[model samples]
Target: MKRTLVIGDIHGGLKGLQQVLKRAKISEKDKLIFVGDYVDGWSDNASTIDFLIKISEKNNCIFIRGNHDYLLHKYLTKNDTNPMWVNHGGASSIKSYEHISEEKKQRHILFLDHLKNYYIDSENRLFVHAGFTNQNGIGNEFNPDMVYWDRTLWEMVCVMDPSSSKNNELYPKRLKNYSEIFIGHTPTTRIGKSTPQNFANVWNVDTGAAFKGCISVMDIVTKDFWQSDPVWRLYPDEKGRN
Candidate 1:
């Protein structure tokens, strides 16, 4: 059956990404939606981008922009190496590209430049790298940065009163905008979960592939999912974003 798969944050773990893809039995017939942060952790940053670019040629995919992707774009296209970024796996991303050809680097830049801020599928499922703050919904977002940086949406959902009806005035209007929301920026590992998690209608697929956890991909319709081995095991020698 045709399926729409929502992928979680990769964080340069090309091996883990591959594992999940294969384990999930993904095919060209299925639509793949990457939630983002494809770089800036493991040693495979450049390779990860190359793989994504190459795979996109044969598979239907939607690439959403994440905070790390935007940061890497700044460094690649503008030479901005913000210290905080360097501290947060940016150095690893830079190292990965050190041996790459300028031609490939340019291609990577193009890929990064075209990443979408968010995607709403035909079923009204919202897919974004992070959270959006506008209670009125993503279409009316007041700040563009909020789409890729806000954590309030996820935080709110995590603490929301699940029994409250959408019609309740005290309920969050943001959650009411879509049938379901898929995001990645906030890893479920942070909350002590090493698997895809759902709170209200928001599903956080980021299982912390940037850290010691694994990568995840979920069939949005059936809610069935697949995961890779812990990323730390895949790149045992590296600290990744730990």
Candidate 2:
């Protein structure tokens, strides 16, 4: 049987990403859904993109756009080296491209440019980099930028009454539109977790690979997950997104 896997924020930890894939025993038959933040934080920003692009060519993959990814794309294509971005992981990403050929850099740019803001699978499961604010759901989202930048959806679900039924009046209409929602951006580590976290019908897969935590991948249907060693251990010499 084919497995559908949902991956969390990578944050340029190519080692973590590779470890998880090996642990997961990934095959061509498996479908990979990446929740983004593929670049920035660690030193392998360019190398990570190269690996992703190469793997995508041979395996089924859906890549979502993350806020950091947008920043990287802006820096690459428009020269918008925003200071805030630089202070928060963008500096590493910028440095990673310093030695790349212009042609390869352009290919990476195209890859970032084409990342999806959000994706809804055949199972009516929504996969997005962050969260959407549209109470009516992603289809009715007004701000395209908000889809990958909003934290309201995650914040809402995180505090929801887990026992509340869907029929409850307080249940969020946005979540009701989909069977389940998978998101990254806000790391589970914030809540003292280094594993995939589920609250209500939404799952937060970002285990903080950008920081001290590990990278995680989950079999969405089975709820079985695999994680790499802590990213800080993977790159002991660098302070990744700390």
Alpha carbon lDDT of each predicted model: 0.93, 0.93
Model 1 lDDT on a 0 to 1 scale: 0.93
Deviating ranges (above 4 Å) for candidate 2 = none
TM-score of each: 0.98, 0.98
> After aligning candidate 1 to the native by TM-score, how far in Å is the CA of 229 from where it should be?
0.2
lDDT score for residue 203 of model 2? 95
In the range 1-242, model 1's lDDT, one tens digit per residue, is 78999999999999999998999999889899999999999999999999999889988999999999999999999989999999998999989988889999999999998999999988899999999888788989878867888888889888988887888988888889999999999989889999999998999999999988899999999999999999889998899989
Q: Give the TM-score of candidate 2.
A: 0.98
C-alpha RMSD values across all candidates? 0.8, 0.7
Q: Which stretches of candidate 1 lie over 4 Å from their true place?
A: none
What tens-digit string does per-residue lDDT give for candidate 2 at 54-162?
9998899999999999999999999999999999999999999999999999999999989999999998999999898778888788878887889988888888888
lDDT accuracy of residue 219 in candidate 2: 98
